[model samples]
Target: MTGSGTRRLGLSRVGAALARGWRAVSWYVKELVGENDYERYVTHLRRHHPETRPMSRREFERAKLDRMDTDPQARCC
Candidate 1:
């Protein structure tokens, strides 16, 4: 219990540190990219992570159903 509490405290400390770092980075990014171009960042990600098979609504539904069938225990009562 003591170890778990210590680990939780350590994680919180790390999160705080990361939040501070991210704030600094975000401010720098805002200055570098400007407010207007901030939305273009998503296009950059999409360029890197191009889709293979474009999913239709039906395909998505079928895939979800198949997954639920495969894992009976995952289904809620």
Candidate 2:
């Protein structure tokens, strides 16, 4: 109702909006760069193959690169 109160509310709303926008941007960048691949793979393994262990991040990246190199169709040119 008061001027200072209105300013505080406006600033809080702007801060929340900025936080949400930052999260969205961070998620998009991680997805675009395949940074979430290991997490996704682990989730899939837990859901589909609970008995198996998922590969380490380093191993997974190395294998992915190898696959891309050996199989032309694995990666976009």
lDDT of each: 0.69, 0.94
Quote model 1's TM-score.
Answer: 0.40
lDDT tens digits, residues 35-76, model 1?
423345446546776665445546655766797899988667
Runs in model 1 lying further than 4 Å from the true structure: 36-77
Candidate 2, residue 66: how far the Cα is off, in Å: 0.6
Residue 13 lDDT (model 2): 99
Which stretches in model 2 have alpha-carbon errors above 4 Å? none
6-66, model 2: which lDDT tens digit per residue?
9999999999999999999999999988999999999999999999989999999999899
